[model samples]
Target: MKPVAILYDDIFLKHDLGPGHPECPARLQAITESLNDLRQDERYIWVDPPEASPDDIARVHSPQYVDWIRQNCEAGGSVYPALEGNLVPETYPAALKAAGAVIQACDKVWDGEWGGAFALVRPPGHHAVKSSAMGFCVFNNIAVAAQWLVDKKKAASVLIVDFDVHHGNGTQDAFYSDGKVAYFSTHQWPHYPGTGSKREDGEGNGIGANLNVPLRAGDGDDEILSAFNDRLKPWTEERKPEFLLISAGFDAHEDDPLSEIRVTTDGYRQMANVLKEIADDHCMGRWVITLEGGYNMKALGDSSRAFLEGIVG
Candidate 1:
């Protein structure tokens, strides 16, 4: 098997939103640079992401929302960041390509053409709703990719896991009513956008399909590990999903300016290892992770490199 597929380009890093934005252009630069510096792995292949067509997006989003995004992108100016149910301009295409990369990685992994893949693109998609962009996301990339795997590829049940410091409300929203997918999230509760409450279980036939593990402000490695072993792992073992999609974000690192979770770069390694084993045992070693958040440059770079190293392991 070749090393993980990396979907990235300098252009993907060039969509700037000016200074003081936590979601800076340098975040993408940090990921690309970290991937370039890895010496232990030589099998990683880098590829530029193409724009996902409207049909590809319609799998999880409404055609009207898709049309709105195109209009915003065409109008072009600093638009309000998309989150949950609203999409601003300027963030449209960026979100689209970010979602495209995850879909591309999914196609690769499901085809058995690769062991795994990492989508290093950004303007992270976890907060974006199917019909609206939220939390700086215009499209729910991870959710869309999972939907395609379930509907088009006929996956028995796809597991979507998000470890971003912020909860993946948008990803959860897409699958909350669909029983064919499971959404598991570990995020700081009472944080930004603030929607991953434990009581927000799945709706209708999707009851028990959604699981939210909200970490306290100071919770760190030990607590995360406890949650994984005591709750996440046991539940996942019974579900035995055919594929796993990770919303990989390193903002939980102690040094990040983002919300406090006190996790270290090593925390990412540990989490990646756990997911890798789960995927291997229950999902034929298939997994695709996409970037979410990690504002501090050093933490972002270090944790990302650590994650790729674990993938290679």
Candidate 2:
């Protein structure tokens, strides 16, 4: 399988949160450098993430929110993850492209050009809501992409797996009542933006479509892998999703300071391999992932390489 296209653009380099913030611009540089250092293989198709139009973003976001972000793009100030109330105004075009990169990734993955794709864009996007921006995110990238596949691509089933240390509340909120997409997440409960509870299965027709596996703080690879076997795999296999999207976050790594989940670098590879196998079996090998969080530079670089290696296979 050809490595899923990675929508890359240097413009994502300028999304500065502020001095010494954990979610710094340097993270992307590390990922890019590591990817470049690897030998060229048949699996990769590098493509610049073209800007996503306002209409594309509107698929999952409120129009007013999109316009507000455009107005605030260059409005720079204090950085977030706020120890104090520091308001850092998001730069306009940077947020647009970051969200856009994922949009393009959605298009590519749905078209079946590559087996799947990963968007290494930043100001990582899992935390942003439909009308509010928080947690260093300006747009809900994965949610928008999921909607595109359902609305534009005419997909009847979509599966989204979020492995971020923090619950993907934004993504959940977007699809809370919709059964067209399946949302599964494994995250640290009682963490930041605190939402994903084991009881949040879904509502109405989407009742069982949303699955939450709230891992305790400090759970390591064995625990996560068990959760995958006991929960995600069985559920996803039965659902037989037509398209799959991943909210790939490396913050669970032991080296990362953000949360207490202790997933190692090797665990990341194992999980990627498993996820890829699932996609191949169910979705005709159509899976797309977008970066969410991984603060420690070394951890992000290592984990990203492992993920790419699995994708290229």
Candidate 3:
């Protein structure tokens, strides 16, 4: 079997939010510690990705917004109210590496150099919009990668599947009016960011290209798995995407402090299995998974390990 690439960099650890923020560097530390055993396994390979160029990021973000972020980071790191985090000098470069990691993962998988790849990055993106950062994310890493696949790689169609507990408002907004990319998300409704309603389908050329399954606060593994099997499966079969991208978030884990959803580690495994089958059937197994959110360190580590195991199997 072809190995899966694990894209990571120590620079990610330098993107510190604050002294006592939820999105801290320890999130990656916990994940690395949990997956330490995988380093000895031939099925996985670790890679250090290059920083994303300005043009590369411009695919999803406006030049003005990008410049604003860079200027702020350079000027002693001010806090953007929407981002809800304190940005240090390292934040901009770390965000660049984060997006670049996802782009590299897509290239490696699309070139058949690897069957799949997981971009272990932070700060978690999915919440960053085109104009500005929000919800502790600097750049919309997965959105940038999806656009890269469509624009640079010339992929006919790309699909983004986000299972984050919070709606991927940034991702949906990125492709809401574009037909070449499809966005699907299963998130908790009446939650943070307050988007992702069933009635908020795509518009214009992107009609029917966006799908959202908003679960309740107490919803658990059964609800999420059913959404994947019943909703996402049929939607994917019709789209038959050329490339698949996953916004993998473990905050839905039962032990997670951020949300009430009760997804367990095994739940993530099952979801990964389903997503892998979809990719294998339609995309020739061309897919990349990028980290999004999971506040509970132990839950994040364990759930990520389980998901990778399922994907590799």
Winner by TM-score: 3
Model 1 Cα shift for residue 250 (angstroms): 1.1
Model 2: colliding residue pairs: 3-43, 73-90, 73-91, 73-92
lDDT (10s digit) by residue, model 1, range 1-313: 5567788755456555555678778887887777775434567777787767778888888999888778766776444544322333545667678778888899889988877888887677788776776776767788888987887788889999888889988888888988889999888988987899999889998999899999999999998877777888998988889998898888889999878899988988888888888888899999998988889998999899888777557
lDDT accuracy of residue 20 in candidate 2: 77
User: How do the residues 1-313 of candidate 2 rate in per-residue lDDT, one tens digit apiece?
Assistant: 5555777787777767666778787899889988884437556778888777888888888999787666554465443342222334535566677778877887777787666788988767777888877787777888888888888889999999999999998898888889989899989888987899999989987889999998898799998888777899999878889887899999999999999999998888888888888888888888888999999999999998887776556
* Deviating ranges (above 4 Å) for candidate 2: 1-3, 74-90
Choose 1 or 3, whichever is better by TM-score: 3
Q: After superposition, which runs of candidate 3 have C-alpha atoms over 4 Å from their true positions? A: none
Strongest candidate by lDDT = 3
Model 1, runs deviating above 4 Å: 81-91
In candidate 3, what are the lDDT values of residues 203-259, reduced to their tens digit?
998999999999999999999999999999999999989889999999999999989
Q: Sort the candidates on lDDT, descending order.
A: 3, 2, 1
Question: Over all chains combined, what TM-score does candidate 1 have?
Answer: 0.93
TM-score, each model?
Answer: 0.93, 0.93, 0.99
User: Distance (Å) between predicted and true CA of 271, model 1?
Assistant: 0.9
